[model samples]
Target: MALLSLRGLVKRFGDTVALDHLDLDVAPGEFLTLLGGSGSGKSTLLRVVAGFETAESGAVLLEGRDIAAVPPHARPLNMMFQSYALFPHLSVAGNVAYGLKRDDVPRAERDRRVAEALALVRLQGFERRLPYRLSGGQKQRVALARALVKRPRLLLLDEPLGALDANLRERTGFELRALQRETGAAFIMVTHDQNEALALADRVAVLEAGRLVQAGPPRAVYERPATRFVAGFLGGANVLEGQPDGAGGFDCPGLAATLRAEAPVDRGTAACALRPERITLRPSPLAGANASQGVVEEVAFRGDDSLLLVRAAGGALLRVGHAEEDGAPPPRGSTVHLAWEAAAVVPLRG
Candidate 1:
């Protein structure tokens, strides 16, 4: 059974619809990340699930019980906001114990739970520190401890690490995953960062315009997107517009090449998503299918890899990501051949 389920949820704000009959499920002890851009309803869905916003229709079920009418404080869940939302006047232990105190738990039990929560987040010695004295990562852990102190069945995180620096964010992501595993609590996180979503989630749910475009394991969704939008959104894929050539091939005007498809496609206006990392660059053209010659229009050298924009014969600039281990990429304006296996060509639904 699902720990939480949203069935045909609909929410709107006068002239605009924030959630459009969306449905999703969260398994117990699972970490699911909601991935989308701005105005894509990722945050709105979190708010709805936290009981801060009500849906116009559909059911919010927690372990088979409808909780749509349940008040925020009455619901057995907690939300950690992007800003951490730590109280300025409260110390670390005070903040973590706030929820327990509100529920009128016995003082002894509250203190014990607060200590455990702080220890879980690795903040055992920082109990009396003020929020201002703590670092960004420290503050984040405090907020997480506060949410976990309640031992709720479900926990919602909205951009939990968005405020940290790049290095801290990456480190914290690994810690967050470890903490979730240690506690065995189900988590539903909302993040616009693709790397964060892909790295920390057991499953990823991609949303668009208040609708779920795709939801599956990270590798499955990344390798086989259900739509063009999903392909471009999750990982920066190069979408090529083409038509079925009445054979087991696709004629893409952008590449000026008839590429072989792994599977037969329908006869109509068709499209394929090619990830940059899948293509290999060569000095000379190879005599086989799925090979094209192009000129290097631009080159960007990242620490571990390099990105090259190759202008094909048909005037399209294809982004290619080459690893540093492959040696230095060709200079700009150099002609090169690009090749990939047919399996790398992912077909997209219209």
Candidate 2:
């Protein structure tokens, strides 16, 4: 059995459904991320698992036992909130030791666990400092240490890195993932940030309107999204509608051209979701590739890469990403060609 499992999970507030018959499983020591937009039920699912919210009908099983009836503090799980809920008056060590003290654990054992937790989060020497004295990242570490001090079987993170700056969030992602592996605990984090989810998760569950649209490893979900919502939510996708030409290519009427598709197309109003990064751009169309001619509409600089929005045939706006080697992009209004390999196009049901 999986370390954590949610079966037929459903939650509602009056007429609105927060979660809808969702089923998910987290493997032991796996880092699973529930990714979705606000009101997409990611937080509600976390709250349910944390025992802060009760689902209308479902089973939340931990280690093969249903935990639906357990109280929040009684469950062998810990939650770290986005606010980093560390007590301002207590020193870092004191904050981490609070749980042990509440449970009437021995003083020596409490101190030992507190020290180990602090070390795990790389805040070993900062235990003497108060939350107010630490940087935002440091304070977050204290919160994490406090949660880890108990050595919970599963860690629930609700936007844990949302409070940190971009650089600190990136750094903390590495720390959180490392600490999870070190402690051998399952980590389920909730976030709307697609990049963060893809970066930290062993598997990502994309929720939409209280339903799980897709769930898989980051690459699988991003490269082969199951639904239109999943395709857009995971990352940028140029969705195109077309009919199969029976030669493993699409007679795409939208783009006014035929494009290569690796798989034999399924019948129906099918579409192709192409990743912008997979499309190459140049001054002219390639000889043996699926190519389109367009005029550069906009050039977006994103540090390591640049996004070129090209207005192609049939006035379709196509996005293309290329390495920003010289950090210079072709000016708007310049004609360009965008091409992708046959294997690059992902066929999807419309």
Most accurate candidate by lDDT? 1
Give the alpha-carbon lDDT of every model: 0.91, 0.86
Regions of candidate 1 where Cα sits further than 4 Å from its true position: none
Candidate 2: residue 78 Cα off by (Å)? 0.6
| Tens digit per residue, CA lDDT, model 1, 230-254 | 9888888888888888877888888
**Each prediction's TM-score against the native?**
0.98, 0.95
lDDT of 2 by residue, 1-350 (tens): 79998999999999999999999999989999999888999999999999999999989999999999999989999999989888888998999999899999999899888888887888868878888789888888888988888998899999998988899899889888888889998999998788999999899999998998889999989998877777766787988877888766777765677777676666653788888888887666766437778888899888899888988876788888878874577889998777888778877773
lDDT of 2: 0.86
lDDT (Cα, 0-100) at 239 in candidate 1: 86
Colliding pairs, model 2:
none
Candidate 1, residue 331: how far the Cα is off, in Å = 0.7
Clashes of each: 0, 0
Provide C-alpha RMSD values for all models, in order. Answer: 1.1, 1.8
